[model samples]
Target chain A: MRDEFRADLHIVSQLLVDMAEAVRAAMRQATRALLTADRKAAETVIAQDAEVDSIYRQVEERVCDLLARQAPVASDLRAVITALHVAADLERMGDLADHVAKTALRRHPSPAVPAELRKVFTEMAGVADRMAEKIGTVLSKPDADRAAELDRDDDAMDDLHRSLFAVLLSDDWPYGVETAIDATLLGRFYERFADHAVNAGQRVVYLITGEPTA
Target chain B: MRDEFRADLHIVSQLLVDMAEAVRAAMRQATRALLTADRKAAETVIAQDAEVDSIYRQVEERVCDLLARQAPVASDLRAVITALHVAADLERMGDLADHVAKTALRRHPSPAVPAELRKVFTEMAGVADRMAEKIGTVLSKPDADRAAELDRDDDAMDDLHRSLFAVLLSDDWPYGVETAIDATLLGRFYERFADHAVNAGQRVVYLITGEPTA
Candidate 1:
């Protein structure tokens, strides 16, 4: 590769790493906002989504520029395209954070989620955070086994989701139908957030092994 | 492109189109199963889902092979990657259809939805089907204007969704909470299915104009 092209590739790689970190930060802030019902924290998450979105756009433009200029081949092209998809998943994760925050604002003054449900959500968030953290590692080290472990963690999130729904279905819950709906939607957002993280991890597997994993 | 590469690309493209059509057919069958309370039809939809899943995996494998073999650049690369993403969306849509059909099966013998509710669902299905058809065109033609119109149609689906929920929530409703929950989940599946179709259309716009919408 030419020196200038090599230099641009390094910059692109750095940008991708930084974008993943930004996505992780957004997920953390959003989870905090949901768990604590902190309006200011939620606002911070909401505000940072624009930054994530901007970074996503920037990454995409840079990728397109690289494709046009250097005409990346094989693994290089996979890296660029995978970065595009991971950036999107991260951006949507931010949107889900925004969703959780919006839900918090609406259900404020009244704690819509019971303490037990909150416990389950906290666990789910942890699993999601771990998965998002691994997307970066998976990208830089495409052959790593850590990506596979992230897939395993997604199972825990699914379990939590099932438990949440089971609680909602229980007769002991005297909460109104609206509250149940809110809880169900909230659980779904978290479940989907983790699922996207799993997707990012799976992309890493595909980037390396060239095969889709469950 | 070499003659062999071009031939393979042609085959892959045709398969992608076929997979989308098959998904649409599965959805139609599932919707019919729901409207008519046909357990037999519901089972058929469920059985066909395996075929849809297999086709999606085949599409994924072909796209990955193309990415590795031809190393397509720029627009060609975008088209291949978009095909993979669109295939995933289509497969997920089929699963949602199966979900709807399963709900129908559960409520069979004593029709979960009344004639009025069935009419609403039939109309909603018509709108959803159009959105799916538009998505197929958007993928093949990469037309920005047509893609934008699909977004407007999505709004109509949202309105229908709200109306469905409103009817479910009314005091005049005679069904139990289980029935209400089933309706809510069914409506959600269709709503989300249309949303993904819209996402596919948006990607087509991006592919054509190299600009992001929403």
Candidate 2:
């Protein structure tokens, strides 16, 4: 029974890594769809979110079962419980990507971003992709030091999000209210996506160190 | 030992209820500050969030300690674990309220809502307060049926959020980009505040029914 429980725990960790990879693909496609106005790509990203949700449920069920059957104590208990929250964070990150996809679908054939802000958003998307990659690495390895870097890397995304506001609030701002709202909402989605990645990474740090990130 | 665990569990519940109430008060002050552009009110809301965080940590520590010592199983286990997640949801709700207060602080002396949208936001704030109230009641009692009502009540807030989009997207939108962005983000913060409430309440339902809320 004990060995079986430990094996289940290992399976849960692997499932999260797989889930993270799937979300990364969705994030890439969703950003592409948003930048290029590809409805098909957007639709694909939206549909793929179902897979992430499925994995999330599986992880949740496994955690609950482990808690009930094995009754893991101390660090083992923390690891299982932390896995649940990390899965939730991953699922939410997938939803954020879905939000980006829906934005693309809403403005289909007309890129959701203004031409002037295109470069900035492209950078934001790049940062998001890098962060997702880092998340996958941490999930697979559970390295606290590497996980710690996700936040430092995320500062770029946050700065870009604020820069988006500077553009919108500037005296020379020329975009209509619609474009401004689109940019604001999109910027928020990407920034939050990175934040969730940072959050997930921080959870891994907690799991490894047996200490709260704060 | 089991009886002591039950007593500790009861205390956790009470702490969560009191935490919910404090968060509700913060929500009230933050919304008032946002609509009125009252700097002092916003500042107070901002400052009070620390107490909510402090209470959150206390709840978490108690729950973790209970898990470690009691080794609760089945429904007993579910209650304590659900309490952990619910407390987290509550903490996030408080942070959302703090976000609202900060937005108010950022736009000090200039009302966050446009003149025409004032009535709608007033209604949104009322809906949020009502949801928070229901959450408090349910936290104290832990009734699945009562907790189920939270999602239905949340529909009003969702509708209001949609109404915000309608205003922003309307061809007649007269506000500048900055105001449109502000209203869009503010609308989202309130909508999510209600969402966290529903999430917390749903966890209560799970606790009662011993069933996943999916």
Candidate 3:
């Protein structure tokens, strides 16, 4: 029974890695579409969301199955429960990517934003992408310290987000309200993506410490 | 052992009820702040989030303890896991309320959103609040039919969100980018809140039906 449970735990970890990677890829596509205004890439991200959603469902079912079949205890139970939350977080992150991509599709052509502002948005996407990668590492390795380090990326993203808006509010912006809304939504999607990644890292810390940290 | 497990299950149900009520109250506070731009109400919602987070922690710990100690099987295992996921969702919904209240505080003097727009937002919040309540009932009762009905509310919220945005965009309002961002973010928060509540209800359905549905 113990060996079987351990094997099931290993399977759960692998599934989490898969879910995280799938979401990271979707985010990458979404961000690329946003930066380049690539309609095809945006459409691809939207199209592939169903794949991520299905994987999420499978992971949830597997975790429940493991609990029913193997009856995990203590830390094992925490791991299974954490897996469920982690999958949900990743799935929502996927939805955020879809949001960005759909918004990009709508805003494509006619140059909605200035080059400098576009650079900042792209950089913010990079921050979110790196955070997503760090989340994958945290899930696979359960490294609380590494998770904490990656967790602070949200603060930096927040600073960039504010700067991005300050520029928009300044007299330099000429593209008008439509462009501003697109930029604002893009900033928010990246910010929220980073936030969920932070939440994932925080969960790792909770799992390691057996206490929920801020 | 079976009877002891059932007792543990009962405790889990009670915890779900408690957490759900806490989140409902928080949503009410957030709505009051939005409607009235009441700083006091916003502060109350922000302050209450800590309690919501703490209750989330307590529920997680207690559920994990039960899983570890009692070693629930089959449906019992599903119930505990569902409770864990649902509690996390409720906690997140509380966080949304905090976000809404914080946004409300910043927008105080309530800068000129039309009555129609306000009405849609109010309806969205109400749907979210009701959906959260319904999920709690489903958790305590394990009623699949009621869980199914929650999805209808989600559809309603989405419709309102669409109409709200159309009104915002079609208007020739001169308030500029700030108001647009505020309106969009408010709409997104309520939309996502309803989404999470839908997820919670879906989880309840999965627990009872042993099948995944849209």
Candidate 4:
């Protein structure tokens, strides 16, 4: 392997890991904003998304340069292409966190989740954070076994999403329609954040094995 | 243009046009299913997404072939890359319609939207269908001017999405929690459907002008 090309690959992979960590931090802050009505935290998450976007665009340009310069074929080419897709997923995970933060900012000083829904969203946030952490791990190591675990990890988020529905469906539900809408949107943000992480993991596994991935 | 490469590009663009049309029809059918409680229509919409997925994969492969064989740079390379992005948006648009259909199928005989909210979903579906139609037209012509029109079109869908909130927030709201959850999900599907169309339009503009669209 040429030392320079190896360096390029290393930087690309490392940037993705950095982006995944950024996504996790944003989600953690966004969750705090949503749970505690911390407007500052929400604004911070939203502001930080621009940095993620810039890094995403930079990674995109680097991939294009490598493709044009190296003209890589087969598995090497797959690595570059898969990196593009995973970069996109990481960018979107950041956007999902931004969405959560915006919800918190919009509701400012008032909890997006009513008292009843707080515990479930908190759990959802925890699951999403864990998934984000795993994306970084899988990116650094490209472990097919560890990458496969994200799907099962996401099932817990889905189950939490369903529980949110169950509560909304229950006759004893006391919240008004505003609360219902906030809860629904907040739940979806967490669910999709995990899905993007799962997507990134799948890309890692595909890059390692040259298998098809969603 | 070389005769063979021209033929390949033609096929790729045509398939996207076809996929865009399929997206429109799927959303139309899903809206019918949701509004009329037609399980058959919902199933048809769900099943048709597979076709969209196949076409998307084919487009991707063709783009890779073109890039490798043509080694297109500058505007030509942008066209190939932008096609990949547009194909993704089309695939996701199909998935969004499928989500709407699944919601209908899940509710079975009961309409997903309560009687009062039916009018709004109908309007949202109409906006989505119109946007999908525009995507087909833009793909065929590559008209940068026409591509910019999608931005304003998406705003209408966003407005319709907000209206769902108005009804939900109303003190006179008569629906149960199930209805609230269903309405929220339905609104999101249509909103995202339009957003994907807008994304495709942005790609079209970028391909034509080599300018950033989003």
Candidate 5:
């Protein structure tokens, strides 16, 4: 029975890692769509969001089944509960990526990101991408130290997010209110994607240390 | 043991209601601060957010305890899991209110919302407030029919959010990009607050019906 419980827990962990990967790929494609105005890439990200949601639902069902059948306690119980939280954060990350794709599609042929601001967004996307990747690594290994690194990556994303605002608010910004609004929402989408990634990392830390990260 | 589980579940439900009330009050204060540029009101909302977070932590701990001790199955297990999800949504609702308050503080004595756009924000706040209140109602009663009403309220919020962009994009708009960015983000904060409320309502429906709401 103990062996079976451990196996179930492992399955849950692997499912979370799969979710992280899907979210990472989605964000990468979404960023491509934004940078190049690739309609096909945007459409792919928007459509594949359902696949991420499907994985999230699977995680929930598996966790519920484990709890009902095994009645996992102590660290095991924490692991099961944390899986639910991690899956939720990853699901939201996928949605953020979809939001980015939709934003790109909203402008269609015209780039959602202005050329002047594209560098900052590229940096933001890179940071978010790294954070999502780290989320997968941390989930697979359950390393508290590795999970702590996502917080630093989140800081980098924040710096990029602020830089995005600086450009938007600059005296020379020629993009009218519509473009400014689009950029504002786009920046928020990337920033929140990082936030949710950090959240998932924290849940992993909590699972390992039995102590919630502040 | 069943009786004990029932008692504990009741406590969790009541805590969710308290959280709903706290979030509703925080949003109300936040909107007041945004419209009036009242620093004190903004400060109050920011400070009281800790109280909401504390309640959220309490809910997490209680749900953990319940799961470990009772190992509830079937409908009982669904109720416990839904409590955790609902608590999370309510906690996020608190964060959204904090975001609104901080936006108001960023602009200080000048209103974060322009005088012309105040009516739309007021309408948005009203829809959000009503949705939060309805979350408490649905959670307490576990009525799927009542929970479904939050979806309609969310549609109203979406309309107000769109109308806000129309105002910002108007040719006669005198406020520049900085104000536009602030309004855009503030609009998103209120819109997401309603979204979370709708999410909470859906969880309640899931709990009662044993089917996830689409």
Candidate 6:
């Protein structure tokens, strides 16, 4: 029973890492769709979100089963709970990527991100991608120091998000209100994706240290 | 021991109800601040958000304690897990309210919402207020029928959100890019608040029915 429980915990940890990787890929493809207005890429991201949701459901069920049958205590219990939280954050990241994809689809054949702001969006995506990668590492290895690094990546994403607004509100912005609104929401999506990644990292930190990070 | 566990479960339920009410009040004040440029109201909501966060932490701690010590199975386990999920949703609702308040504060002395869009915002707030109220009831009583009503409220909120974009994108929109962006984000905050409330309601429904709601 003990060995089986340990194996189950390992599976849960692997699932979280897989979720992190999937969300990273989704955002990457969504960024591609956004930058180039690729409908197929957008559709692919939108369609595959169901897979992320399914994985989230699986994590929840497995956690519940472990709690019921194995009754893990202390750090093991924390690990189980943390997996639930991390899965939720990763699932939300997937949804944000889906939102980015839909935004791309809404303006199909025309790039959702204007040429002037593509650089910042690209930078934001880069930061988010790095953060997602770090999340996978932390989940897989449960390293507090590595988890802490995501906060800096989040700050970088925030800077990129603010820069997007500066460009949108710039005097030379020619896209007008409709595009401005879209850009604002898209910026928010990327920023929130980074925020959730930070949250997932914090959960892992808490699971390891038994202390919540601010 | 069983009796103690039941008492803890009861306390968790009450905490969820309290969170619902607190979030509802915050949104009400946030709307007032947004419409009338009431800086004090905005500041009040902003400051009181810590209370909501504190309550959320309390919920997490209590739920974790329950799960660890009691190792509740079946319905009892569902109740504890649902409490965690609902508390998260309510905490997010509080954050959305805080966001609304901050938006109002950002335009201090100037109404964040324009005169033309006040009615729609008011209606949105009303629907959200009702949804929050129902959330409190359902959390307290665990009635599937009452919990299911939040979906309709969410639909109402989505309609209001759409109308907001319609007005913002209309040809006669007098607000420039900055105000438009603020309104867009504000609208999103309210819409997401409703979405979270619906999510909480569905959790309650799942608790009662042992089935997920679509």
Candidate 5 lDDT tens digits, A99-127 = 99999999999998888988999999999
> Across all candidates, what is each one's fraction of true contacts kept?
0.10, 0.61, 0.61, 0.41, 0.80, 0.71
True contacts kept of 6: 0.71
TM-score of each: 0.84, 0.95, 0.92, 0.96, 0.99, 0.99
Q: Identify the CAPRI category of the predicted complex in candidate 2.
A: medium
lDDT of each: 0.75, 0.88, 0.82, 0.86, 0.93, 0.93
Q: Write the per-residue lDDT of candidate 3 for residues B1-214, one digit (tens) a residue.
A: 9888788778877877887888888888888888887889889999989998888888887888887787777777777877888888888888988888898888776732446577888788889888888977887788999999988999999999888777667757556667777778888888888888888888889888889775
Which portions of model 1 show Cα errors greater than 4 Å?
A2-13, A140-143, A209-211, B1-13, B53-85, B102-119, B140-144, B171-177, B208-214
lDDT of 6: 0.93
For residues A24-108, write the lDDT of model 3, one tens digit per residue. Answer: 9999988788778788998999999998888888888788788778777777888788888888889889988999889878878
Candidate 5 lDDT tens digits, B32-117: 99999999999999999999999999999999999999999978988999999999999999999999999999999888888889
Estimate the lDDT of model 1.
Answer: 0.75
lDDT of 2 by residue, A123-159 (tens): 9999998888988998888788999989887999989
Tell me the alpha-carbon RMSD of every candidate. Answer: 3.5, 1.7, 2.2, 1.6, 0.8, 0.9
Instruction: Give candidate 4's error at residue B70 in angstroms.
Output: 3.0
lDDT of 4 by residue, A91-160 (tens): 9999999999999989887777788888899899999999999999988988998888899989999999
lDDT of 1 by residue, B1-214 (tens): 6676668766766776676677677778888888878888889989988888888778766865776667677777666666766776787888888888888888886665676588678877887888888877766656789989878889999999989877876767776455666667777788888987887777778768877686
Residue B144 of model 5 has an lDDT of: 88
> Which residue pairs collide, candidate 3?
none
Candidate 4 chain B has its poorest 10 consecutive residues by lDDT at: B70-79
DockQ for all candidate structures vs. native: 0.29, 0.66, 0.62, 0.58, 0.88, 0.84
DockQ metric, candidate 2 = 0.66
Tens digits of per-residue lDDT, candidate 4, B47-119, equal 9999999998898778777766766665666666778888989999999999999999998987778888878
Stretches off by above 4 angstroms in model 2 are none
Relative to the real complex, the DockQ score for model 4 comes to 0.58
Docking class of 6: high
Q: Which residue segments of model 4 deviate by more than 4 Å?
A: A1-3, B1-4
Q: List runs of model 5 lying over 4 Å from the truth.
A: none
Per-candidate clash tally:
0, 0, 0, 0, 0, 0
Superior candidate under TM-score, 2 versus 6: 6
